[model samples]
Target: MRDQEPAPFDAERRLSTREAAELLGVKPETVYAYVSRGQLTSRRVSGGRGSTFDAGEVEALARRNRRDGSGGSGGGNAGGELSVRTRLTLIESDRYFFRGVDAVDLATRHTYEEVAEWLWTGRMVPGITFTAPPGSVSVARRAVEALPEHTAPADLLRVATVAAATADPLRFDLSEDAVLGTARTLIPTLVAALPPRGHDRRDEGPLAHRLWPRLSMRKDPDEASLRALDAALALLVDHDLAASTLAVRVAASARAHPYAAVSAGLGVIEGPLHGAASGLAHRLLQDVLEQGDAAPVIADELRAGRRVPGLGHRLYPGEDPRARALFALLERIPRAESALLAARDIVETTARHAPLHANVDLALAVLTVSCGMAPTAGETIFAVARTAGWIAHALEEYGERPLRMRPSGLYAGPRPPQPLPE
Candidate 1:
């Protein structure tokens, strides 16, 4: 037979959650988490209280978990699933902690830079501000400017990171102090490199304020909006061992410089499954607003065999904690009221079919849509905020033994000793 696309995984066979979870060697909660994250889908039979999983999907996920025994397969393995432990962040039920502290509390009470410093060093640096060197800014901005004008926000940040790495002679230093310095400067440089909206604005105040002009053209943004942006950054600073973070750890394990480690992460996040999810949610909300009803918009999406984005998450079976926290803050913004209502409409409308809860992407969509930002703005915010997390993971990986993330591939192809093709 000619080479063909792998068939879409469907329920040729269905297994109860217990069977599926046992097949994957995980607890029932983990199976639910897998379902929530889109790693597997849960199907409920008529007159049944519990949901069953497609046997094919369950086996595929099992293969993924076993391949090199890492959470994100084919990237590299730090350890088996739940074995990539770190003191950086922990996700429990629907809540997450950073260094043993409630992340939502920290983000709401402190600035993004403060929470980031805490994540990096476990110390609170009150009123810390990251200022990129003029030389680095010049180099990064020039490199970013050279890209095609329609270049994506994440791609722009990646190019800027490479250029900034070139500007710093000590990029390969790998010492804690040097990496911390690079992190402080590199993050600001990433933000500054983007061509500013309205006019070229000088860096000032918190990192969120500096990032605002790059994502939004509105001048003199309000205090509340800036807080929302800052809170979003802090909340998104790190999620333990996400695919991009794993890519970063793998890079750092290989002794790639911090810039390069973050670059590796950026490369992984440009995919629709990760960082671009927020953008998808943004466009979804926009569609709902334009149509004046979420049912029809979501119906169109479902009819076309598309998922309603920003609806579910892997770690949170209930509403995402970040989404809950962001929604609370968003409720205070008068302008966000309409978008928030629309988001609620979307969730309620979709719940008529699937019981998925709102995720951080939906909350981010509300923020971007209400703030007069572009569809790409949510992903931009995510990229800038997540750079801190990539660096944090990089720092953690640097403390480990060198080249620890080696993958053991399971060859499914024809045996290598087979004769060469005629």
Candidate 2:
């Protein structure tokens, strides 16, 4: 009667709202609801008597609804699944503790290695040496060799990790403890294998002993400077999930290897807004010393309504814990009189002039420069120490799903279209 109706091809045919709902296991009314809610797109057909939808669009909507936990059998959705939220440990809080010990207390009382052990192994061991499997040593050696000559230990670390991952066929297995052990082992080893300096002296011990030779300027180690460096590293270990840590977690969520994940963290730290703050701090301190008084410099800066570098923080409302700890340590060290006076003057003037307090960066800059470390080394030393935190955050991210961190925003721009030259 209707010119012999053509045979229906199930594979290529568009789906009607009713058919789409049936395929999605939902009622036609639900499909209309989706359209009304702008969750699904539909096309008007036959003078708007009915609507047609692409089969692919229907499938995609079904997948999204399922992911959002809004769709499935019995009118249930996967979107309702409980997602685990990460607990952020900030530096300012009294409740923030590591390995059952307060971080502020640990930074004051422990060496850098001790703090590293605490973070890596979740124990407050007096000393710990991270050990890699016998098979991994050759890979580590090869990685060390492949790095460019004169590379800093920290830079070599970035190269070594990529090499190690490329060499290891079994690197992708997701064992939490195993990966952490590897990180603990690799970090100390990388520190030891950095490009050797002629003036550096070797000493007896594990991590520090191995690192001592690479960082020394004479056959005998500078005990005072080394002690200062140790305290500095311990203090810089972690500072909540700042921007750089967030970047590390994001990369880890993509199932990136530990090295790649840390590399992501390093990239973020390289920016001026984050880890480079210490470098700025170093320069600011140099200016104060060169100008011969901290009050005038800080006072003029405050009067101009410009924020001084190495002061103020988004987290610490009153003061930086690391700053207080490091400053206290610096006070007891011998022959630090000029630097100590400058720091005291700066602190008093800043307190009198502005609400901002000295952060860890300022204190660290004074300690490092006063100990004769090169200006650039301030940031490098920070990276070497903060690696522990980056690895910890990365490990935490690995346990979570590969949920893309796509923050939504309004799409305001030029309006959609008008005939140009009609």
Candidate 3:
């Protein structure tokens, strides 16, 4: 049996570094460099025999290098996921941080304004305030009111964002100072533009207080409820590279105006699988509230091959810290005990059946229920709070390579004829 031509670069086989280097006409060290730069992915051999690369990916990189004239050296991988660096937020050890401050601590101690400042400017500037100009508020309000009667609150927010942008003649300023200034006013403006809940009070507290009447049915929400809403906003200020954050960054990377970036974020967040998860969790909590038993509900959700909304986060191995913090605060509220108990029941039931733990969505859901807010209140809260994060991300992305998020497709269609007759 002749030594049949050593199986020419088997695309199905995972290649060793040396094998990949040989096929790509590069050194083994260069192969390792590609892995480090995220141009290629590597996995350890089962028995710890160094590392291996995906053969198809390696070939793709080689072809891309040849076409681009860069020889697989710099820039992002052609057919690989891009991992952009950001200093805004970090998720480590199941805890989220903005800059260096823990989010849970911020939720408890700092106001939403302070947290937003930290995320926006990397400094915890105290006494910073955000107030939408009365004229801008009027414009946004008119935009919000013009929507169809059944428009969701989140959609109203999106329209308000665009309206505010249109009203501000200076919205094109991309400088950090200008963007931060716009955001400071933009958030409060959006809050004020929400359909008023008919609660007119002289004492205007934090943004949460200003926002409470809009989110809840109560004419005057208690201090504890206001605090919970504030914490929800602060806790959601920023999370590293969420889908919506990525959308904001992508828009910013293309030099879209700040409002456009924010609108992109809102649009992505409107998806049921993202920021709207809390609304589903709200419904689930409603069931728990009415039935007073979570075991059967949990069983039904799992039986239908459905995940319990607001339970389990891929990033947090243990309980979500934000959920824990909010639950603690909610448990302290006088009338929130029943909602808290329902939350606990759902959590316990979820844990026994699966490793699913309560996440931020559940926290928001229970908080809304406790405070007697509407079913869509959690989503409204998420969208508004997450605006701060989206702005922060937009600012960050503005400083990076423009339009770096453009992706390539791996064509899997049938090949065309090489030479067609005219």
Candidate 4:
């Protein structure tokens, strides 16, 4: 008998069109279009006429397209745009959705500690606990103690981070888990060190609950109010590689330690063009309330060619998701009738005058005032909440290979030959 024919190798084991599209981060239609255009080659099965492309071929096409600035993982290149690269940790999707649940929903149903835990570690359960590495606790404690008496909690945190970084032997460790653990411990410790502002210290719960005494004039926030604030922080915690996050990663790219990286981020955030807009928005609302109408005020400002702050963003075309969420929470407050009216009038007036829509800064400003926090503390609160994201980005940057960020510039100056009179 003739030897049995050797079993034929299976070629269809390679990626299907759908799998190829998923791996390339493009739509299936795009993959099919590529095959149709001969940009990628496909083979038909012996019995069936349908085509299947080799996975290696698809990957090679992606690499070649990326090199030629044609197309790659993300999408089409009709605009001839190079894909913007970033080494920062992105929380857009994962932080937005956890355990198949929305972060906004979890924020409403859970405490700030639980949310922090979920962000720092990927778990939704309560067994996770934060502890500073052996010597880190002592260093952090000493740093906190060394802060000038009566310093605001947020400022104290700034000072303590610098000191803790100086004290830590492992401060150079840029591992994700290490940095997140450090943040978990650092945030709670800094909160605990804040000077008592009022009489709310008797409340029992997480550091955020205890922090109320140091940040609010009200001795006790009603349960509803506390929940709202908690949700607000959760919503504001992170966005994808924001400007401040970019600053942190840039600093880390220079090999700065975590504290220095965060400090750089804070400096960027303190600018009026960034985090301070929220405080400005609150003041603007106050002015509108005092003046009894916003339409004329807004019209006058626009007529004078002055732009109102906290009304717009480069992202979020429709309206800010965080702003909408916070506004919904603010509407629940019992005595916010005047503020609500002012907010409505401002929104209408602003829309009529410009394309800008209300962003999170505007809503956060209103909420800060409603919470009885001092006007200056509004920006400080934003810094505190965003530090988690900054540190995460810094750590991610530290792990990536360093690349100098210098860009070429045009020589616009005229050549100088003759010397000026001495």
> Candidates' TM-scores?
0.82, 0.70, 0.81, 0.69
Order by lDDT, highest first: 1, 3, 2, 4
Q: In candidate 3, what residue range of length 10 has the lowest lDDT sum?
A: 69-78
Candidate 1: what lDDT?
0.89
1-422, model 2: which lDDT tens digit per residue?
Answer: 56988765354458887789866656677788888878778888877688988777787786666555564332333445323234334444523466556776887677777787777667678766555444455576677777667554446666656665665676676577766765776566556445445645233354544554554343454566566667778777777667777777778878887777777777777665677777667776877888999887877767888667788777677778778877777777675667767776777778774777788888878875676654556666677677788777777777654633322233568677956765
Q: Which stretches of candidate 3 lie over 4 Å from their true place?
A: 1-81, 201-204, 417-422
Q: Give per-residue CA lDDT, model 4, range 220-323, as digits (tens).
A: 68876666676776676666567787777778878887778887777677667777777778887878888999977787667888778668776556677677
lDDT of 3 at 100: 80
Residue 70 lDDT in candidate 1 = 49
Which whole-number lDDT from 0 to 100 does residue 102 have in model 1? 96
Model 4 scores what on Cα lDDT?
0.66
Candidate 2, superposed: residue stretches over 4 Å from native = 1-84, 93-96, 131-157, 201-224, 299-306, 415-422
Query: What TM-score would candidate 3 get against the native?
Result: 0.81
Residue 234 of model 3 has an lDDT of 92
Predicted structure with the largest lDDT when compared to the true one: 1
How does model 1 score by TM-score? 0.82
TM-score: the better of candidates 1 and 4: 1
Residues 1-422, candidate 1: write the lDDT tens digits.
Answer: 98999977555779998888666765577788787788889988789789988888888887877774744322324634535658899999789999999999999999999999999999999999999999999999999999998899989999999999999999999999999999999999998898887794768778999989888888888899999999999999999889999899989989999999999999988888899999999999999999889988998888999989999998888999999999999998999998999999999998988889999999999999999898889889998999999999899889875775764467799877889789
How close to the true structure is residue 196 of candidate 2, measured as C-alpha lDDT?
Answer: 47
lDDT of 4 at 109: 72
Q: List candidate 4 segments past 4 Å from native.
A: 1-103, 127-156, 199-204, 303-305, 404-422
lDDT of 2: 0.67
Give, for candidate 2, the lowest lDDT window spanning 10 residues.
81-90
